[model samples]
Target: MKYLKTRFQWIRWAVHIGALLPLVVLIVDALSNHLTFNPIQAATQRTGDTAIILLGLSLACSPISTYLNWKDAVRLRRTLGLYTFIYAAIHLWLFVGADYGYQFNYIVPEFLQKYYLWVGLPAFIILLALAATSFRGAMRWLGKRWKRLHRLIYLGAILAMLHLALVIKGDALRLSGDAWKPLLAGIIIGTLLILRVPRLRRALLSLRHKPVAPAAVQLASPPAESTLVKN
Candidate 1:
């Protein structure tokens, strides 16, 4: 158990580094003026993509724990979820602050014109709530209700995928243009959700715990027994 704890600690640190690396790269790129023709747009898209990827990872924790019997994976959920929110917040800020100069007039008009913007709003709100109540204190305060609230992450994931599908320059239904990203995201998210089903999860757990059959042992020749009788 101590070894497991130490291993989990290492994994946690790795996750921390992995999660923050994208933001660091983004900042470095911005500093070096390497964010392509539209820096703000590039930053916004990158941050949003990172957030969705983290969110998918967070959602994967339970399935991984069940299927692989890696209990440590569940512990990483909160960390991943928090990172998802961090990137999501940054993504939104880039949209409203960097892209629109934090001008409500311009932001509101864009929101009204863009269906994807409003579609993503609820996902961000859900992430905000989950992040706010992610601590031990909040867990204690919410008790059983905390889980119910956090489950909304799945809904948020769905909305986020829709937002991505809409924002990209393609028809998701027709599978053309830049639709592959969101389609892939949807498939992954859908698989994660399916794995969370109680029956499937229980089946996976059973498979993990199932005992292996022992090999049958064969006896040697009876000639040895005749020699032992002489004693």
Candidate 2:
């Protein structure tokens, strides 16, 4: 109980600190003119990469905790997921406001007509919905549906990869087309996900359920009445 209480306190502090620190850095960078590269692309990439990293972290928490034999690490998953949404929202905002110049007339049509836009915009939309409904309140309200909706994360990842691929394809391509970065990332993420397969899950469960030796089993289980002492 003491550990749990301390963990909760830590979680609250971490959430507040994590949520605010990025905005502070972004502001400082902007004001200090340290935003040296193409500010728009730089910001967008930072936000997007943060989102991907957070999402990966969120996905990793469970497997990590299980392997490490610690239940405490599982507590941070919701916070990680929320941060992912935060970054994803910032990424989408940067794309629309800075990259698109906030011209809906041009933005809407280009987003609708262009193949890359089609790939990315759908991902943003899904992430928006997931982020909006990430709270305990929303989870309770959605009940069984919450999990179903969040399953779209995989789809979002795929779409985001496609978006990145299409964007890079438009850039200067060497003979190789420079396709490996997004592809490799996608493969890593996808492999992490594939570890959740039900057959593999059952096999793992069966392995865990392996019977103990007779001596240990005797130690754990109640002895027979004949082996007990009346005294």
Candidate 3:
């Protein structure tokens, strides 16, 4: 029991520290001159990837907590989700500022004419809205409506995966790029979605119904004390 509690504490601390590591890596790489590749593109890709990862991680929370019996760890799921939004916002800024130069002339045409842009742009828009309402304050303010709003992330995830798939296939010869990454991401997302099926749900419920042993409780015995007051 003590070990479990300590491990939980460690996980919380680790996650807090890990949250800063991505930004730190970016800054350190820039300072060390190791970030020579297109900085904006790199940032954008990392941000988008991180966002998807967070969404998947958040979705995994319920299954994971159930399996591990670690309900206390559920708070980390929300933290992971917010981190996704952080990276997503960074990705969007880099795309607009670096690629479009904050200019409407170039950006406007792409959104109107490009097919992939139609998918990716709307995905980003939905992400923006979701991120805006991610805070606890917004959750309380919106009450039950917040749930409906947040469900938008599901659509965002689908579009993001599709957009990435389209982008990767855009250049077949550029196999050295993110071709496989998107494919792998899509597969993972698909698996997670499949696990949510009603049949699968019933199967999992049956499995969980199996009997399990209770944990042993450890208690320290109190020290004995003798007194002469009885004499």
Point to the candidate with the largest TM-score: 1
Q: Tell me the spans in candidate 2 whose CA falls farther than 4 Å from its real position.
A: 1-22, 169-180, 212-231
TM-score of 2: 0.74
Per-candidate TM-scores read: 0.86, 0.74, 0.77
- Write one digit per residue (lDDT tens) for candidate 3, span 44-151: 666677777776776666655654556765678777767776776777777788667999888898778877667887787887787778788999999999999877
Structure candidate 2, residue pairs in collision: none
Over the stretch 1-231, how does candidate 1's per-residue lDDT look in tens digits?
A: 447666887888899999999999999999999999899999998999999899999999988776755678899999999999999999998888888888999888888999998889999999999999999999999999999999899899999998998899888779899889999999999999999889987776665454534331124425553343322
Using lDDT as the measure, name the better of candidate 1 and candidate 3.
1
Query: Which stretches in model 3 have alpha-carbon errors above 4 Å?
Result: 1-5, 169-177, 210-231
On lDDT, the candidate that comes out on top is 1
Each prediction's RMSD over C-alphas, in Å, is 8.9, 8.0, 10.8
Order of all candidates by lDDT, from best down to worst? 1, 2, 3
Cα lDDT for residue 56, candidate 2:
73
Tell me the whole-model lDDT of each prediction, alpha carbons only: 0.88, 0.73, 0.70
TM-score, candidate 1, is 0.86
